[model samples]
Target chain A: MTTTTKNNEPIITVRGLRNTFGEQVIHENLDLDVRRGEILGVVGGSGTGKSVLMRSIIGLQTPDDGEIEVLGESMIGRSEDEAKNIRRRWGILFQNGALFSTLTVAENVEVPIREYFPYIRPPVIDEIASYKIAMSGLPANAGPKYPSELSGGMRKRAGLARALALDPELLFLDEPTAGLDPIGAAAFDELIASLQKRLDLTVFLITHDLDTLITICDRVAVLADRKVIAVDTIPNLLALDHPWIQEYFNGPRGRTAALSHKEGAAA
Target chain B: MAANGAGKARSSGVLPTEFISRTTSRDMADVNGTSDDHQGESVYRVAGALTITRAATTQREIDALPDPLTIDLSEIDRMDTVGAWLVYRAVRDRGAKVVGASRDEVSLLHQVSEFDVPARVRPEESSSFTRVLTELGEWVADAGSTLLGLLGFFGATLIGFANLIRRPKRFRVNAVVQRFDVVGVRALGIIGLMSFLIGIVIAQQGSVQLEQFGAEVYTINLIGRITVRELGTLMTAIMVAGRSGSAFAAQLGTMKITEEIDAMRTIGVSPIEALVIPRMIAAVIMMPLLAFWAMLMALLGGGIFVWLSLEIPPLTYVQRLQEVTPITDLWIGLIKAPVFGFIIALAGCFQGMLVQGNSEEVGLRTTTAVVQSIFLVIVLDAVFAVFFSSIGWR
Candidate 1:
């Protein structure tokens, strides 16, 4: 609900993006522009390539054809060495956490810092890691525990801690609240919103949680028919006559989410 | 004079300050800044980008500054959480006041200060001597419990067998046959080649020693007795333990991790009967047959080597083998085979059932299965050797 003044200049620009896996086409001629300092929630039905689009932007999956400009750097066809500087500016949190199984939560957070700034002393890195871990809402004791030792929710927080370790300008969260309970999901959404505001981050979020969309997202982009069908605020999107978008926002669960959001805001 | 002296002191303090000014450039140089006024107050100016990449240098500078400090951040081009943390920690610990920070930088510093929980980076490790002693004690206790667990598993397997016998309709014919194809049929080629090569090496070595005594024909006796009574079943057991025992542990461990075994239990299907029993039965039934086949292959290899290298005919070699290798030697080898097979399968399945937690447990359990089964097989073979000798079977 706290709206930071976002700039008009796009932090990320995608045009004519096409992606395919063997015979299956996931996207074609997709266009998206994520403005600076805004949390853009991406939503679609299952198997509509929400994750695939995220992967394409992060350079994990190379698109057959596209132009991707992130922070004014062309992302397509760039080698790893060339992408290192740009890569450092963004952090990604995969679904299910995808934490390193062997390292503890604190150690996982330290990994990115150590890799980027090897000259930093161990004590400083440790202090920074603890700060990030606490900022992500994990308990202090959860630092020493491995990924396997924690619950699904704790693991996701640990993953977020690692993602925010370097104070990345851009953050990519794939289903940040997918497996969380209702209360836990709301807390996570609040954390994301607060962190984005404090750090001036441009968040590209993929989610299925209606409450998340209604509560925190500055804008929602709908993926359908192998491309983003519409991109606008939830109310504006609801006004449109797109069938999928209509059902998505006005559905039973969506109505309940909207009502609760309104009630919470009123209170 | 006082104002001029304060101006000189402030200029000297700010002029020599070394910092990286540009984001892309790594060059360190003096940047613009102004310190405290005419009063005796102490102020430190931080210039350039205060980010993670320059955290080491910034931390050192922050630590070296005098107490009752006022940090000036007006010259900072960029600032991140790491930089904010550095500034926040100084202010909190040293009671320093921060001035001239941008709105965004002030918020970032405030946010970093809010997360001021003391967290241990790693688990506390005990002293090396105590750790070693503790590890040794834990290992012994683990081994003791593992032995007891294996015995309990054996009892469970026996109960499973009894239940299947009581209800013959519950027997899984397809599962057992599939296990037979995996544990027995597929292992034929490698086991055969290994036994054949071992036979040739033994014959070649034995003939050389016998030739010195002008009794080269005795090599046939050595090859026949050793292959039939000891090497055939023992080597085959070792190979099967390496190949099939490790696989059983890995498969079952994966199933346990994925909760497939739990699902089976919920559906009223016994994993012991569905998974372990089929593998156990197949190993028990196939070991003696594989051992017998290995013994024949070894004899054929030795026969061929003797015929080619020693100029002895295949017929003569076969006749000598028949005379030296008694029926009791074959019985001894075949009798040991089923016992070895049972131990291998039990060790594998036992380790697999013990696996919990992540996929790493599967790899560890698989390794333990192969090692424990092979060690038990060798120990049991030694016992069989003593018992057979005492019974005058040799």
Candidate 2:
């Protein structure tokens, strides 16, 4: 079915996805696709279910009804082993960097590697984990520190390293820049952009950070009114007359991001 | 031309499109059957995706070709990391032959193959004896700190009590009453039902055993003595440890995590007085009352069981219960209640206050609180039993 798209295949494809909590409809007939080797940004107002949408795709939150496919495998009703296999292929960095409090940063990075690649020697796993930690932009000495000891930004990096433990093809980030300062957030955005290119990762980035969208995202999907209203490049999105999109993109913050992006491109 | 096609991407490496063009959609050489791209001798034309998602099919297509076959990179469309890896694997298998990839493809393929697995170095394993010694040392340190924490909390509560005595306006009466209503009043149904069933089991079991010695009437003595002296307060304490003890840990631990306790301290409000002192006072006041209620429920259950099964009348059961159980037994049991309550409350508050960070800490500490409280309760009961036995209470 996807062969008709000509060149690139979607790493993730969701068609008519619906999710609700009791009478609260979070998403309805929502559709999205994360193409391979593309950083796709998901943006929405609060309570529009950006996290809920990510959670659904990752199998953390089950949708009420929908079709979700990842790498040609249906994710909606997949068995545990199948789901586990899919999970092994992709990694999710939660909003708060939910690293296990008991483990050091290095050990946290080794969790998925240990789970999926049990035959790999612990020493090799340790080496790979450290490499991944370094790759995620943390210093070599940061690996021994506990999550609680690290700053908010450092914890997010540790979580990214842990997510990249298996060298996943796809990366899901939930508000990666939510808690960081502007410079830190921009650095994070650059780190993600570099990592995506180096690893050929298909990134599903859920963020409220306009700078992240302008800097890294190849395409941005706007979620509104319980479904995806528009999916296009930031430039194309800016031209839309949708009230929410207009306010969100033409707001002071959005204007600053656009100006900075133009200056960055020129520089 | 190659640089122009690579677009504004900062990385000079072959973008996924390093292998772009020449597939024409009709011939998916990489995914299915090999297409004839007779660029040169021994050329195996590849097309379509060669990424990780389709690595299996793509690898199979590459493998089916004759050895020493060259992969025509120009015939391929998209080549990602895994796709590059599979191509590299083919190249490694073929043992280096003539190659012709676009500049982008060559660079990407080169970078992809650079991901090499390094040698492993095992972590050092400590000797079992040394590990055990270290563990023992840590345990002792932990015990000391825990004891100190409990004592410190106790002293803080006492000082708060003194302050409250001096100026009653500092008291959070509403909070104290709320804690009392939740901890004391809410737990009644479960405590009552459990005691009644325990009473029935004791009475029935005692009657059977005593009947063997032609002393069936001694069921009264067994029920009265055991319920008043041991089971009443002991069971109530254990139940509260599970119920209210864990609650206190969770509540206070959550407060600590959310910085509410820190906020209180910042505002010159003592957490001990506002949180711990109220719970302690409530427990101290309620434990004796709850134990007395549990004792009555147990006696009622015992009376009903004996009357129904052993043909003992209710009036006779009551009179016999009074004769066997002295008022001193009641006092001994009631006296232990407050002490047990204080210990349970202290255990919960200690663990709760110990919470350093995270929601998981709250949960872990809550479990620890319940376990420590119940173990302490049983230990206290045993200590009291020994003291009463030494004084010839029985």
Top lDDT: which candidate number? 1
Interface RMSD of each: 11.4, 8.0
TM-score (all chains, Cα) for each model = 0.89, 0.80
Tens-digit per-residue lDDT, B276-334, candidate 2: 98998888888998899899999999999999999899999999998999988999899
Best by TM-score: 1
- The reply for model 1, stretches above 4 Å from the true place, is A1-5, B1-43, B66-68, B207-216
Give the Å shift of residue B202 in candidate 2. 2.5
What TM-score would chain B receive for each of the candidates shown? Answer: 0.86, 0.78
What's the lDDT for all of these models?
0.87, 0.80
lDDT digits (tens) for residues A190-247 of candidate 1: 9999887677788999999999998899999999999998899999999999999989
lDDT score, residue B96, model 1? 74
TM-score of 1: 0.89
**What DockQ score does model 2 reach against the true complex?**
0.16
**What does the lDDT come to for candidate 2?**
0.80
